[model samples]
Target: MRAAIANYWWGSSTDNRHIHWMRWGRLTAAKCQGGMGFRNLRHFNVAMLGKQGWRLMSRPESLCARVLKGRYFHDSDFMECTRKKHASHTWRAILAGREVLGQGLIKRIIGDGSLTNIWRDRWLPQHFNGRPITPLADQYVTRVADLITASGQWNEDLVRQVFFLVDAEAILRTPIRGRGDDIWAWELEKHGMYSVRSAYRLLENQRLH
Candidate 1:
């Protein structure tokens, strides 16, 4: 398909040899950057797969998710699931998409901090990697729940003690509502809906930079 598109765009000369002017990579750049906003097939494919992966993660109760979970990831969630030795092509594709999701997904903590790990999860918004930069200060306080009081309030003193000054400030700034469950949200989308365009743009930007 890519070859055909390139052929069409850079048609053959009189000698039947293609007269390419610009490279395909440059042509795939966004129009604002001076190139046509053509989709880079590989990134676009992964972005599309990322949308499918998002659907699976968001709609765990769906038949497709249920079936795939039962077969490939019954013991773990989609984002953390691994590729088995004999995994099908579809599963591999979804996992590839999940990688893209991992790049931009973050847990939206709603006061109930049981779902996130204090150090492992990307819940810290201010940090560059969305995680606390401080080394673990205490051995026992491993989960975000440990930093929350019984009344659904942050244990300010405990948090400050558990992290460095910067991380403590970032954690204290995170507003925690009394919502029932913490949820994963897409950082690239305002409404948290995963779309191919957003994922594609993210991939493109990452590649360029």
Candidate 2:
């Protein structure tokens, strides 16, 4: 379908063996990059599917998410779920673009911290190395709340025991807001909300690199 659209825009016809004055790849580049601002249909499709996956991850209470989960990923986090054999085409399409959604998604920690897992989540502040502190942190310290006190403050001693010195320091410096639930944020946007524009931009940057 995308190929057909590209061919039509480039003036290719069934009867003529004419030259394509400009190749499809060049013509599809963004305007700022010196081509027609035509959206790459393949990437756009994946990105749109990614937005649905994002909704499933962040809005599990929605009817669509619940139905998918009951059928496909009952025991795993949406991001960690895998496609099973004999799945519907719709399920497969959403799974295909899951990685694009994961890359730009950020989990913000707040309140009780029960939903944020300490060792598994990316909530730790980044260091100079560009990696979160202690990517190899102990698996024993599972939930982020495990490192916090009943009084709603960090448990400094437990954090030191579970994480490396540097990571422990970083964790101690992190604060949890007292009244709200943990939330997911789209790191690409200022308001921390997901947008198709941000998803496309992320996909474009990734393709370039």
Candidate 3:
């Protein structure tokens, strides 16, 4: 991830003389494209958490956010809150985990359909025409599928709700073809009704809510 960010910021030199300039977007292409495929850690971190923001915004009535607010935040931003005077190793580990996971490859899919459908659709095998789920992609695919199944609804209103919750204005702007598709897909795919339901169920199971 550091290498990728460095490459994006500073162009690689070729043959110890020539300089090869690569734009941030182009440099971020998958490894198969001859790029390192490292995601910008900060950007990916924000993107990953954007789903949570979307959830809280979309479901203000949800008990999870309310509990979180009362526990550590007290109506303050999560990033700004510092209730822990000394950050524990667990907290540092969590932050490190976020950095590592966020920098890894992200596979995003988008379609003008329900979030469940978009998430459940699969990629086909090389030898077959029809889509066949593979174990390798199952982790990511299942994560999305489970999220949609847990989150109940996916509609424009939910999008707006999340947008306001995150205090992000870009969601209101016209969507860009590729970039916007990924961001929008990430939000809708992860924060649907299924996700909330699953979280609520977990909280109930743990007696945390």
Candidate 4:
């Protein structure tokens, strides 16, 4: 398919012979970066597969998501799940796509903060590294819920004391008004939802950089 596409791109439809001015790779680069912006087929496939993996993360309530989770990662989240020796082709393909998710996957703090670890999960949207810059305090907090007050607000005094000033401020700024589960989201999009378009762009940018 690639050969046929390349042939049609630079040569006559009736004949294969033509003067190729640029390589297929350059043609696949972004148009703004001085290339034709053609989609790299392999990268696009991975991005699409990544979308499936992302759905498995974001839509745990869906039938497909639940079934896959039961079969694969019943105890842990998709990101932490490992390969099984008897894993199906579908599972392996989804895992391949999931690999593309990488560090871009971040948890949005929504309802109760039980699922998000205070020291580990990437929940701080404003912070550069996503996780808190605060050093772990001794046994005072483990989950994000520990940092929340009884009124569902941040434990202001504890937050200020336990975290560095920077992290304290970031934590204080995070809104936890919604009564939903803490869920994983793609950090690249404003709505925090994953799309093949965004995934493809992310994959392409990674290739370029």
Candidate 5:
């Protein structure tokens, strides 16, 4: 479709020999990079679908997420769900965008930390290796709440024993609010909000790495 649009825009016709000017790659370059700032169709489609994936991740209790989860990922994380051969087109599209969403998102623990599993949940900052703080983290603490004392402060001694000194220090630094539900955030964004634009940028950046 984009090819057809470009052909029409440049007056390329079957009856006449076509003359090429600028390349499509340059036309699709961002405005700041000195191009036309035209949206890349493939990226735009994935970004639009990724918006739906973000909705599923952020609004797990919403009707759409509930229905989709029941149908697709009832026993697994949405990020871990695989595409089924008989799935609907919408489901497939959403799954495609989920790859982008997963790369740039992280979990944020708040208040009681009751909802997070220390070894299983991604409450810590993502490391370059993308693994938990310690290989034997599950052997140390079962849940994030376990790291908290009865008085609601982090268990510094226990943390230092279970994690590396560096990781233990980082864990101690995570703030605990008096009361609030745990939330997830887009690690790449400053405001902790998910946006298709930010997600799309993440996908482009990932390609370089």
Candidate 6:
């Protein structure tokens, strides 16, 4: 299953450059694009799992957060947490995840040993913008600050309003069709509801009445 998923993600091309290009494009369209229209399962998995990381970074008081602080971080920010000179693969992976959160993008090459130049250029501004907070935006700003701190990037507190502002702008600029369509359609066919939200509401109504 894992090998199949990896093959689907990386494509069957033996040439390294072609494989890289296909991975970069994520997936191809069928008939019109002259290829099978397949989704990159690895990318999809990362995107979905990234939400859980967001939730974890959002809720600092959660048990998982507490455990992480006690075990790996020891209450230090992610960047401050240190292991042996040569860390294990698991440690390296965790650090990589933290680096991604710190960078806010996955464009940088991994295993480079040094932070990329683009990181310095992009991160500083984002960090500075996160600093100032108004009365109404304090909670969201604090959350962004926590994420920043945990990621060991910048100290600025990005206001939730501003974050959402950029988010809305991006959504408007680059439209996405069939977002979550596979998951929703699968659920609807199997369980008669398109989402957990509708299913939960139905159960709640039955319990109450």
Q: What's the ranking of the predictions by TM-score, best on top?
A: 1, 4, 2, 5, 6, 3
lDDT per model vs. reference: 0.84, 0.75, 0.37, 0.84, 0.76, 0.37
CA RMSD for every model?
Answer: 1.9, 3.1, 18.7, 2.5, 3.0, 17.3
- Residue 46 CA error for candidate 6 (Å)? 3.5
Quantify how close model 3 is to the true structure by its C-alpha RMSD in Å: 18.7
- What's model 5's lDDT at 195? 79
Candidate 5's error at 153, in angstroms?
A: 2.1
Span of 10 residues, lowest total lDDT, candidate 5: 128-137
- Candidate 1 least-lDDT 10 residues: 11-20
**lDDT value for model 5:** 0.76
Instruction: Report the lDDT tens digits of candidate 4 across residue range 1-209.
Output: 77778888897476548877889899998888888888899889888898898888777799999999999999988888998999999999999987678656777778779889877788888587788876665657889989887678888999887888999899999889678788888888898887788888878887888
Write down the TM-score for model 1: 0.92
Residue lDDT tens for model 1, 96-150: 8876788888887875788888777788774778898887654687778888888
Full-model lDDT, candidate 1: 0.84
Q: Judge candidate 1 at residue 128 and give its lDDT.
A: 77
Model 1 collision count: 0
Off by over 4 Å in 6: 2-37, 79-94, 105-209
* Model 6: lDDT to the true structure: 0.37
Residue 187 displacement (Å), model 1: 1.3
The collision pairs in model 4 are: none
TM of each candidate vs. truth: 0.92, 0.81, 0.25, 0.85, 0.79, 0.33
Candidates 1 and 3 compared by TM-score, better number: 1
- Residue 162 of model 2: what lDDT? 65
What's the true lDDT of residue 38 in model 6? 51
Q: Write the per-residue lDDT of candidate 6 for residues 55-107, one digit (tens) a residue.
A: 44455689976776666777564444776576656555555443324323211
